[model samples]
Target: MKTAICYYSRHHGNTLRVIEAMAEAGDAELIDVTARSAVRLEDYDRVGFASGIYGFEFHRAVADFARKYLPQGKPVFLVYTYGGAKGAGAKAVAKIAEERGCPVLGEFGCRGFDTFGPFKLAGGIAKGHPDALDLEDARKFYRSLG
Candidate 1:
């Protein structure tokens, strides 16, 4: 399937690592949501939103992109990395996709190195995460979408 993953990977690039593995395994296109404002995804067979959880949600930019640019009736999927525990990041985006009549195919979440806010004082949480196994799992998740 021709897929495009719109992503925001900041701080430690934890989400980026998983995204890269999924792209390599699935041969999908990557869209950096932070860099682009207008993206056309009509040509893609499936669309994905990926990001590290920020304040228990997908990064604001990513969610905004999905709200503004995601195509109607398209197949959608989610990928996210979190520090302490999995949050509502996936659900937040899925709701947006659903509003556009898109079908949510699946979602994948994993621990990612985090140093945001108070966690920074303790050096960080989920350090050395989105590791080899996590990347492999992300790849497998993407493959299963087909």
Candidate 2:
């Protein structure tokens, strides 16, 4: 299927790394929400939202993009990177997709080196993460989407 992933991966670029690995493993279009305000998804068969966890949610840009542009009943999936936990951001995004009548295919998440907030004072956490193994796992997750 032709897939498009709208994502926001600022700070450490951890989310970007995972998204890149997934795209490399399959035919997918990567959309940086920060670079573009609006996108047309009618040509894509599936849509994905990816972001680094920010305040226990997907980045604002990603959430806003989905709210504004995601098509009704489109197949949707989520991928995220976090320093402390997983699923929170995915759940939030999934809810949005569900409300739009999109069937959520699945979700994938992993640790990304986090230096945000107070963690920066302690030299950060999950250092060196979204590493080789994490990237491989992302590729596997992408393959599973088929």
What is the Cα-based lDDT of residue 39 in candidate 1? 82
lDDT over C-alpha atoms for residue 4 of model 1: 95
* Model 1: pairs clashing at backbone N, Cα or C within 3 Å: none
lDDT of 2: 0.90
TM-score of each: 0.95, 0.95
Global fold similarity of model 2 (TM-score)? 0.95
- Model 1 Cα lDDT, one tens digit per residue, 36-119: 868899989999999999888898889889888888899999999999866577778888988899999998999999998889
Worst 10 residues of 2 by lDDT: 85-94
